[model samples]
Target: MLISMKNRLIATLAILAVLGLATGLIFPGKHAKAETGKAVSPGSRMEAPAKLEDTAGLTAFVDGMMEEYMNRLQIPGAVISVVKDSRIILAKGYGSSNLEQALPVDPATSMFRIASTTKLFTWTAVMQLVEQGRIDLDTDINTYLKSVKIPATYPEPVTMRHLMTHTAGFEEGGVGYQITTDPAELPGSISETLNKHMLARIRPPGVMSSYSNYGATLAGMIVEDVSGIPYNDYIQKYIFDPLDMKYSTVVEPLPKSFIPYQVVGYNSETGSFIPGTPTFEGGFRPAGSATVSAVDMAHFMIAHLQNGKYGEQQLLKPATAERMHSTAFQFDKRLPGVALGFAEKRVNGVTLISHGGSDPMFNTEFYLAPAKQLGIFLSYNGGQGSEAASNLLQAFFNRYYPAPEVEQPEFAASAESVQKYAGSYQFTRHNSSDIDKFFNFFAQLNVSIAGNKLSLGSGSEQQLYREISPNLFQLEGGTDQIGFRTDESGKVTHMLLDMAPDMPLERTPLLDQSKFWLIVVGVLAVLFIAALLGPILFNRRFKAMTLAEKRAVRLSAGTAGWALLSFITLFMVVMSMDTMQKFTSISPLLSLSLGMPILLAGLTLALLVSTIQVWRNKYWTAIRRVHYTLVTLSAVVLMIFFYHWNLLGWQFG
Candidate 1:
């Protein structure tokens, strides 16, 4: 009648877990207060944790890691420095600034594309000006930049804090300055640009953290107007010169200031290294495009380490420096939290403040360990800066705080609950594999009750499904109600899923799993039909042409048309979600359902190319051979990718 000690403990644990689950449902938004470095505020003195552990070893690890990553990331070079206690514990450069000529990178002097790291500098300058009683953090920035105006979406005025923390409601529209896009299309001058784009609110100021390149650029505009100097000139006079950072420059400011060791920035698409574009031509674009060397980066970190002072000159109050490091983006707790222009994460009670930068040809990251007086600056030519930075950080974490292994608990699924999950689900596909990527992509469906919990199905992913009533079960892993609807007699029918709480299959299912390939084949047929029709409609002389000549005409017309369509197809695919990023990323289904037209377009062209060359080519053997060969190759490549992507399936399709 009595339970054993071990069983009692297990039962107690299970009961506690049930109690916890019930409590969680009742009090949903209760998260314990976060731990920061023990009440770190402005004016409160910090007891520095200066326990040094193999500073040189840490340097070698970071440098070696950066150099290795640079080789793969197509980055020209990177400079890294980690300092503690106002001392340079580690500073070095990896890879030549100019990879082609093999010019050496100097840790102390060689320059790099600092990217968004310049925000810290701009913020420092703003804070310095504030301490001197010129600008106010919470005041309307329009007071200084007379030309710039925030859209009157809000009942009251927008403040400088909006621009600083990216709560300014400035829709990015797209990447700040795309390589393919013209700079003319960018926010002309900082003021005009802000006036043109700054809306009152995507969410209320300080309500949600949406990143804004416009906001930071506006700050630069304010710095220029408030200081009565250009943004570049102001930073040079206040931030750079004071810190004695000679190598730091924004955009093309140092166009003529050449260092033989410098590497040109690259265009990501062309895969060829292009020279760096100036971040700001005029007005104020401050969020990105600051070039500096590792040595200069070290100096900047040292200034932060010294609580906003460089050598004898106290640039900002210690309070402001602390403010800059604190959390800035607090919109949704579930999403990654951010600090002003920086990302914040709490690991085992210690808060980590970090930011990553990616330009066309460069990438960079600067991590601050304020308590240890330690900071790491990882800069690279390509986008591998995040990789190197994350790797080094993870390695350090592994070394200092090795996680202890605990026993894995067994999880048993309810068979009756899982039984209801046995039917097919149909929805439009999404562009992103991630649930929220690009908003509503395509419709997705899952049938669970299989032995394996997860598998890579077709071109995308498969989720674990549990049965609820043989045709209705809650999606166990996510926050959605997905059911396999049934016919009157309880027979399985199509799937019904709510991608969004209120979306009505916002993405309607165009291709069921069984018929998706047929649909693709139909697309190819469309191309063929269109190709045939074009010639019949346009080329009057085709009727008079000889058999061989007629064949050549048909192949040529189809090939040319399809080839152009293929190009357009590729372009549209990028715009869908695969490439042309949904800047707002509001709905994932946009690309999945909407992209059907583009996909159908591509398939139609492909079919035209295929059908015309194989069967319709009018016996011009030579033209037919070449045309058919290219068509076959294109089809093979397209199908291979499609099949790989799960868009085309063998057994399932």
Candidate 2:
């Protein structure tokens, strides 16, 4: 089989598909855990320390934790700030900011891209206007927009509240222009970008949350329209200035004075740090483009913890700040939900209002425990920074506010009852109408049964979950809760996790599951191989065929050849690129590869006509005719797969 090029290629593709499926089956991706320590019973609580009386002890713990994380995760640079009772307990830096120069990160002056953490400031600016009666949270967003109009796809208009809670129902947008290394790529203003690339509304407003970067940027534009100033200028004037955060700025392309302090973002490969180009968020700046130092971020956190008062300067009224921290949207009463712009979660038996940020090169985590009057912020410049930040925060909570061990509800649902919820689910925060939709193939969450309990992940990372109540499951050894939503027929429609309030997992249809497609690909490869091999293996019989029969055979073989070849090409192209390249811009090679599916769709139609001609005229033996029909049907299935994954044509702008 390896002697022929066609056979070798077919075998390779089959092996790749098998490996991909096996990987997904045996090691499903890890889900965020609710608590990092022992489980806490319902209605129970564990209080965090009231004050940082042992600052030196806390410093030693942090220093040891950061050093271990940096070495283990290969993070070159990071900064962290912690505040308790409106006082900075620790604001420090670790590792090197510039590897080549050996320049250390400065907590007070060194700057790092805080990414979507910038959205908090943008939301703060909006709430400040709301406090002054300049804006209303419930009004339709279109009323204040001087430019760009959100289409009325649904009866309910998207409001500021919906945007803040990520329930505006807009499909994912801002691809190809959200982040860029070139300054010339940016539009003149936020309105120009929004108007040119307004996203399609996929769901009804204020229904469900799906983290939308476009929604946040639109809210920033509304701030500009209502306040009569640019979004960045408004933040600098209202939030930054009031908080006295001198080392922070939302302005793209840092000023000359701030340039020397900016840390170099890095990607570690084979024990070497490779510096990445400094990225700009362009018109999406309001969503995640601000740069700030650890000390400056401490000021912003302290203000929010102290009810919007940092010294004499009050960025938001006490009542408005309280409202911002309160729960504004929740899918289920038992699970964590969204609080205005903040994501609410119960970790270590205490409620935390937090927001996380990530760009290509930087990752950040920000959390505020208003009840404890404590806040923590950390950002690192490395490829694995997101994982590092998550681990650090989990360790911090487990050390200082560990949950008390308690009995958890046992598995009460029968195997039949649990079977109804077992399937693949796709996250709601994905592109549904573009080439970017192809990436969703790898983002599915698989649910299965583990003996008597429900398993909530894929692969080796599966976590056992028990049904504490109907449709609500809790992690066996942790506090994480996963709630399922059912339709009128009691069929599960969506799954909500306590750790990720900004997105929900919608149950995927049987035909649309990734495993289903993988099986189809494997079967199609076999049929296509047979179709191509039949001519060569039976050349003597082929010579005796009539003109019509020969024509039919040639058409079927050609169609199968194109299907196999084009699919392999598409696979190779996608596997070669990373997530950032796929989302940021479409290269020429990818554009051409996407066009191949459209050509294959045409060939499949031609092959279908040939199959009908073979049957009507009796071009071959019944068994051969049946095999040819199977090959033709396989071609049709391939076309359906292409269309379902948004690969039939060029869908990018």
Candidate 3:
């Protein structure tokens, strides 16, 4: 059967994910344990550690994994450390300090961009306030929040707890030029940011889970409003100082003292370092914009591992830690049980708490299994860090906790409720470039327990997962509840999904991206015909008119043609890099859509230069030679550019 474009994208992603995690699914020779005395290279199979009970092998495993994963991901550098059994086991670095210089990575003192992981810290501070009775979780946030006003979602005010779990229902804004040119605007106080980004809600607070940076910023706003301290300052005084995380800071402009080992963020296309991703100096630090090494990150993770207590110091009550791990909003129990700021996943039935972080071009993930005394902190500068971490997680479970065999379920029970949601799927972020550093390429499970699957890119879609059996699943949320409609003869046809009162989804592009592009083109066509072509087609006379009529017609025709060509050129240049570089094949005098038009202009200039020589009459021969040379250079440059860029995937048409 022929597959659609959307279906093809899903299949390709499944293959990519499986191919990427090759080692994880099929562990052949070695058991998943780390060996002591004989150090096994990270990323390769390891012999089970002789002293399985000893913490030493686990320590080596942690350090080795960090270095190994960084290289696999092309990360500029990483500072990863592991805290197990309430102690720092390994803190190390791999790859280059600066992507340009390709220097050795820093181990102990290097810094990095920790991105949204900063939210965990921000949540930590907010919870600290909660523990102290300075804030109430369920009360309306606007009561404490000042300096900026939030447009409440409903007549009933939403609570702080709602925003904490990303159920605040705030629609997201595009990043890019804003984050690049005016990162300072992001750092403004929380209330100020709330006022700045107060848009309409997507759903009632706590009804559905939708991730929002603006929500976290508001949490940061309340922390500042009620505590009477700046966001980062609060984190330092309460969390960082007490935890002895000396190297940790919400990096804004990055301190000069940190110049030594700090990794420079890279833009892969230009092969240039991206300086100034602007960590939180004063504002918006809550939603994640911070930097630290594995050592410091390990300390933070270990504290959580030990349940909000470090040594004898009780940073947070053990009960509160339990609450943090427990889902405040079970907005999703399918993909993973996401709580306030963390996620709960059962790897082979062993529950673990995990959170992922990403910045301009860096990623960090921490998974802690308090049940098994296991913790993993993975960091890399490039986006591939997540896949590396997943592989490491597989190795980790193999070493510490091998996949246990499950007794077969009864035949009746196995087949009784075999739901129709089954198939692999992935999620691609909307309205963004491939080079974006945001959490744009978020992993979404297409989950199916039986034979059914969810569609990708549908709006207001509720993505859910339900395990029917090990390695089998079903989608539970709105998007997962897909059915089908048929013709009078009862043939399988259009799909029925729970999108706004359980409506039928047409098999066609009810809201396909290309359809929108077509609408735009249709509008342009109409304007072109009515405003430009219509006049010519409806002209009164055919041939033989006054010179004034001829000139007027020519001027109008030229103006309209130029305008139409301009829009077409812009559209082509933006949509397909394939059309940009041009050769003589595209007509040397082709319009601006193909870059050869510039070369043709150069040829005209060269001819003009030669004609000036003829008029001067002194250096006619020399000028002729010079003109030919100029034209030749332009032609050569055009050809070279077209050839090189085309060879590198810039196709000319």
- What C-alpha lDDT does candidate 3 achieve relative to the native structure? 0.51
Work out the TM-score per prediction: 0.58, 0.91, 0.63
Tens-digit lDDT track of model 1 for 1-653:
43322222222222111111000000000011111111111111123331247776565555555555555555666667777778777777776676566677787777776656667777777777777788887887668776766666666566777666655653333321222223454434566655644433534565433454556777788887888887777888877888888777764544567455355554444565555543332333476657788888888888886888778967677987887777655433332345554555433233466655554456566767676566767766654344445445544443443223332233455555445435334221122222121122222433445552321132223334443333333333322234443458755444433211111111223333424544554565454445456557856656766776665555545554554454345335534442123221223343344344345446546555655545654443565455544544444444443433333311110
lDDT of 3 by residue, 393-471 (tens): 6666655565455543322223323333333222211122111111112223333333232334333322333334432
Candidate 1 Cα RMSD (Å): 15.3
lDDT for residue 653 in candidate 2, whole number 0-100: 37
Worst 10 residues of 3 by lDDT: 19-28
Please list the Cα RMSD from the true structure of every candidate, rounded to 1 decimal place: 15.3, 6.7, 14.6
Structural RMSD, model 2: 6.7
| Of 2 and 3, the candidate ranking higher by TM-score | 2
Q: Give the Cα lDDT of each candidate.
A: 0.50, 0.78, 0.51
Candidate 2 residue runs with Cα over 4 Å from true position: 1-51, 458-460
lDDT digits (tens) for residues 1-653 of candidate 2: 11222122222222121111100000000222334362122211236532256888678877876787678668999999999999999999998888889999999998998778888998998899899998899999899999879998999999999999989998774445557777677534788878877788999988898888788899999999999999989999999888889999998888789988898898777899999777787787888778999999999999999989999998888999999999999988888888889988776678888887766677778888999898998889885565566556665666677666678866578888888888888777667787666655666777889875778544444568888899999877667778999999999999987767667879887766889899999999999999998889999999999988888888888889999988899888876775466546677898889888888888888888988888998877899999999999999999988888888887763
Report the error of model 1 at residue 341, Å: 3.4
Better of 2 and 3 by lDDT: 2
Off by over 4 Å in 1: 1-53, 72-76, 174-188, 195-201, 258-261, 266-284, 332-336, 347-349, 400-653
